[model samples]
Target: MAVKVSSQKDTYKATAVFLVLMGVLYLLDKWIDFSDYNLDWVMQKDTMLLYAAVTFLWFKSDKSVGLILAGIWLIQNIALVTALLGQVSTYLLPLTLLLIGVLLYWLSSK
Candidate 1:
C-alpha cells in the first residue's frame, strides 16, 4: 500500500519539526554560550511559544502564513547570531518574531 500525502499535512509536519529543532537550539544556547554568553531565558521561552503557535496554525491555514513565520524565525535566528557575535545586547528577537507572526496572520487572511 502507498501512503497518500497532503500539502497541509506536509506543511504541518515540517513546521512541527522545525519548531522542535529551534527549541533544541534555544536550549543549547542556554548553557553552551552560543549567544555571546547572553541568554535571555524569558525571550527563549517566548520564541518557543511562538513556534508552538505556528506549528498549531500550520494545519488548514494559508501557506504564506507559515512561510512568513519561518521568515521571521529566520530573522530572529540571525539577530541571535548577531548578538552572539558580540554585536549588541538588545531585546530585538522577540519583537521581530511578533511582527512576523502578525504579518503572517495578515497574509494568511488575505
Candidate 2:
C-alpha cells in the first residue's frame, strides 16, 4: 500500500540522517578537543543523544534488539564514561540519562 511504502521511505530517510549525525559526532569527538575548553560535557551529551537516536530506531523495528543494542552500547561506553565522571557521585547523572534512554526505547518499542 502507499502508506507502507511512504513509511518505509521515511525510515530510510531517517536512517540516512542518523548515519550523517553519527559521522559528524564521531569526527567531532575524535578530531576536536572539547576537554581543552572544559566542553567535555558537550561531547558527553552528544554521545547520549546518539545512543538515544539509535535505540529509538532499533526499538521501532524490534524491542529485543533495541534492548540488546542499548546494553551493548552501555558496556562499550562504560570505561570512558567512568573516566568522564571523574567523581563518584557525579556518575549518577549520566548513568541515569543512559538508563532513561534505554527505558524510553523499551517503553516506546513496538
Candidate 3:
C-alpha cells in the first residue's frame, strides 16, 4: 500500500490565510459599529485596511473576490462622483483609502 497526498502551493495558502484574516477584521469592525455611530472615523479607516488586506489575500487565486473588489472600486468612484455632484460629503478620505486598496489589489493580481 502507498500513501498519497496533495498540498497547495504556498502562495495560495498564504493568500487564503490573508483573506480570512482580513474578512475577520472587517467583520469585527462591522460588529463594533453596531452599538455606536460615533466611531465612524475609526471604522472607515479599518474598513479600508480590511479591503486592502482582502485584496492582497485574493490577489491571484480567487477571481470572484477580485470581482467583488472591482465592484467596490466602481462604487467608490461613484461615491466620489456623487460628492462632486453635491450628493455626498467632500470629506472622502476613507473612500480614497479604499480606492488605493482596490488599486493595490489589482496590481497584486497581475
Best of the candidates, TM-score:
2
lDDT tens readout by residue for model 3, 28-94: 7777763375656444643554455455445545455555665565565665556675733455655
Span of 10 residues, lowest total lDDT, candidate 1: 1-10
**TM, every model:** 0.32, 0.40, 0.30
Residue 57, model 3, lDDT: 46
Residues 4-25 of candidate 2 have per-residue lDDT tens digits of: 7766665676566666766786
Question: What's the residue-level lDDT of 19 in candidate 3?
Answer: 67
lDDT of 3: 0.58
Q: Each candidate's lDDT (Cα)? A: 0.62, 0.65, 0.58
Tell me which residue pairs clash in candidate 1: none
- The sequence of per-residue lDDT tens digits that candidate 1 reaches over residues 1-110 is 12334655666676767667787786776667555755555346547655654664556344556656655665657756666856333456556658877997999999
Model 1 earns a TM-score of 0.32
Error of 2 at 17 (Å): 0.6
Residue 26 in candidate 3, Cα distance off native in Å: 5.1
